[model samples]
Target chain A: MEQFDNVSVSKRANVYFDGLCVSYTVTLADGTRKTVGVIQPSKLVFNTGAPEVMELVEGECRVVLPGESEAKTFKGGESFSIPGNSSFNIEVVSALHYVCHYG
Target chain B: MEQFDNVSVSKRANVYFDGLCVSYTVTLADGTRKTVGVIQPSKLVFNTGAPEVMELVEGECRVVLPGESEAKTFKGGESFSIPGNSSFNIEVVSALHYVCHYG
Candidate 1:
């Protein structure tokens, strides 16, 4: 896989995790728009009502939703989700880098 | 409103719309991971079978989904949506800046 380095995400409240596995920002929404680092990989659980927004920044990953046997693959420029408290699994296949905002 | 400049979004496949009203990237996902800039804002219509992923970078905006009377306000670090095929309105209140990858 190719690698890109020394990139900076400009903007007052930009939350990007491409270079580092963490996002950075400061705003009123999402609690000051702070950097939310990756905690751990999770399994996609359907009907859990937990919605999440995943921003694919770099590398590849898989998103598993309900009734979905095969995990949906996504690269660094796409995004999928388990909406509004819907449970799901996010597996970082390669070096995953992306920003995310969850309620 | 405050401004942030000279920020680069690192990563070979990254889509960030800040500094300019355009986002840039290159990858396999979402059609060669191209830069998808903001064209225009539409009304947020809920239950329209359209889902969207919004990456808020800088500035402020509003997203109005159907069944909801008032438009939901989002700042420089938050996002909302009108599902797949769902029509919606995104008003760029104060120099909006963000990234979006849609299908």
Candidate 2:
């Protein structure tokens, strides 16, 4: 996505696997926070407290959230959404590049 | 910068400060490596073994590399280049968003 005005990238952070999965927060002037990250080849599960929109910006991955019977593959320019308080599993076939907007 | 066609965001890595400044490498099909990161407010020095072009994708920072008399402030949409084997100091006034291409 083109850079948005008033969005400031904040201190770096991480999740799940330490250096294998990394990301940074993009905080807007209005206090809205979005995160951008890249996940290396691996399989992992995540539990989230808020709704999230994940946009694939570079590589690709397959994800199967709770209640889903099959994982779906997402490539660059594709996106997926997850409800709040849900969990999901991901299998990284290639390096996965994504920007996640949470609400 | 728009995501390139062949660039793959790889496993996470870091330098200098922990958690405060974070980035991930983008490896290309040709084996070239680039890094994208966001820096929180702080002052830090970095040493590089290869030439680098730092592109500011969001926010701003002031940088004073070796052989430079005064630090230069760079805002979003701007970029600066550094020679190999050099060291540079950065004073982050705001969260700085950048992607570095090295050769």
Candidate 3:
């Protein structure tokens, strides 16, 4: 029940690695778009344009907030937040499946 | 990549048990839409509106065609096709993650 069945998509892309890591995007209902991202076994930095919520839907990864020194590991069902115009780093232990919410 | 990063969804729903199983919809680029379906450990009879390609993204399941008696087991990376206005039966062994394509 964490996802919807009546979802519609207008645009789509695959394996966007112009940045540090690779990820994909899916726009959900109400014009709400999200990135169902997957990170390989590597480290990457990402800057957000809007305040975003990172939801771990599958697999796991380690994340470091903008002001944090210690990176924390997150598994499925866990989530973190990043303010707009902010940046964060992630260390993918294995393959990670995540949904990035834009607001 | 099997999925797109620029995907968009305009409408969404969840756990549609009004049918034989539960599934969700997402519209992708080029006005393409798909159902991220999850089948429980049960047998289900489903009728298709259009020609559909059932892609098993996770877990495993057994499928029986309209005129077939022997069910076939399919795992991740496997797929099957159903003609439009046709009905097929599925026997889910575990939780199955699938992307149902319509054409």
Candidate No. with top lDDT: 2
> Can you tell me which runs of candidate 2 are displaced by over 4 Å?
B1-83, B86-103
Error of 3 at A95 (Å): 31
Give me the runs in candidate 1 sitting further than 4 Å from their true place.
Answer: A1-103, B1-50
- Candidate 3 all-Cα RMSD: 10.5
DockQ-wise, the better of 2 and 3 is 2
lDDT of 1 by residue, A18-95 (tens): 222223332322232322222123332224334556666666767776658777888877867656745666666665
Local accuracy of candidate 2 as per-residue lDDT tens digits, B12-87: 3453364456686655567676677767778888888999998887777899978998999998888999999998
Query: Order of all candidates by TM-score, from best down to worst?
Result: 2, 3, 1
CAPRI class assigned to model 3: incorrect
Each model's TM-score, in the order given? 0.33, 0.54, 0.50
Candidate 3 lDDT by residue in tens digits, B1-103? 4543454432222333332244445655566877665555677788888999998876688999877889999987889999999999888886666778898
Q: Which digits, one per residue and each the tens of the lDDT, describe model 3 over residues A19-94?
A: 2233434544566766654555577887889999988766678899989999999987889999999999988785
**Per-candidate total of colliding backbone pairs:** 30, 0, 28
Clashing pairs in 2: none
Error of 3 at A96 (Å): 26
